[model samples]
Target: MYKTLIYDFDGTIGDTLPICIAAFKKAVTPFLDRDISDEEIVSTFGPSEEGTIQALIPDHFDEGIHAYWQAYKELQYMAPKAFDGIQELLDDTAKAGFQNILVTGKARTSADISLEQYGLTKDFKMILTGSPKGPNKPENIVKALKETGTNASDALYVGDAPSDITSAHAANIKIAAALWGSIIEPEKVAALKPDYTCRSVADFRQIVLPE
Candidate 1:
């Protein structure tokens, strides 16, 4: 029954966490004169490089962002991959007339790289990258829905983080917690009580593209 599908980028559609963690550590270590712990990096990282830079090196924000990407691209081992079944899910959904939107915390350039590398650049009808202009996911979701002429009641937002659940609720849209990504703890995601939960893309396809 859903006419639209909104997705989160990093942990939802692709497995970019490991690469991002490694890249972030490499990028920020020199500035701090010490390596940041993985836990700290995960906690501090947000939807964009600017946010991460601001949190760690506000004085050298622009330079920090440049460093981050340079480190990211150089880490050949950290290349991202689309999760199994994701491409099929996207194709099926689009074929079924569902408007797809990508709402991510990633900067435009990084997001572009991810989509292009993963061969998902054309899957989404609209891609909303991270920006201070309206960094709130709920606001971005609402904007995407409006642009597509889809009502919140007729759409579902799919994501792998607790923030995604909260934002979807705030936007008055249904949310599906994607456990296959596991970016957030499973128990914690359950506590958030997203409208639906899918352990795999196959499970997701059943709910969104049910026969």
Candidate 2:
């Protein structure tokens, strides 16, 4: 049985796509003078805010990145919601004696706002955000394992993006790719060959805590 479960926040636990897209639009529209489509915004879902801004607006990266995060935070503060069944899954995992951690590319402040807004502040044993000091997902997995006093072999990292799967693979932790997320391509997730693929939050519970 898994002793710890580390999750990615944005597309994994929290359904913040609408807020994210709105923020991106708010940040980019003035500069581009054109409305960005939701599909374009959704396609850039996985990376850090800075990374996303840099990728989308390279010329004004320094200014645009800051603006994007500011707008994103403002929007998120007013519109944060947990994914369907996330609370139940977290409760179930806790009941089964598994430690939960949230490791994400979002800044700690933003992550805190979302977690608190969605009433998930107490769900995680620790919340690690992306920073120069903080390691990436693979490294974070090791840190979480050490902090929780668990072995990689006995832990699972669940997420919705390719990077999450890659990081789990790098850390040798079992992975569960969440299909009901921003990545509209299960084929892409399948190509990563995660230890498991969950069609929904309920499916995930069944795998993690089978009857």
**What local lDDT score does residue 75 receive in model 2, on the 0 to 100 scale?**
85
Clashing residue pairs, backbone N/CA/C < 3 A, model 1: 47-105
Q: How accurate is candidate 1 locally (lDDT)?
A: 0.83
**Top TM-score model:** 1
lDDT per residue for candidate 1 within 1-211, as digits (tens), equals 8999999987788878777788777777777877688898777755476687678777877777888887766663555568898898899889989898999888888787788878998999999888733357888899999999998899999998888898899999999998886455788889999999999888889998887
lDDT at 104, model 1: 87
Candidate 2: the clashing residue pairs are none
Which digits, one per residue and each the tens of the lDDT, describe model 2 over residues 1-211?
8889899887788767667678878887777857788887666655566666666777887787678768877886545578789999999899989899998877676677688788998999988777533337777778988988988889999988777888899988899998786534677789989999988998889888898
Segments of candidate 2 deviating more than 4 angstroms: 33-47, 55-66, 77-80, 132-135
**Poorest 10 consecutive residues of model 1 by lDDT?**
72-81
- Count clashing residue pairs in model 1: 1
lDDT of each: 0.83, 0.80
C-alpha lDDT of residue 132 in model 2: 31
Instruction: Please report, as a residue range, the 10-residue window in candidate 2 with the lowest summed lDDT.
Output: 131-140
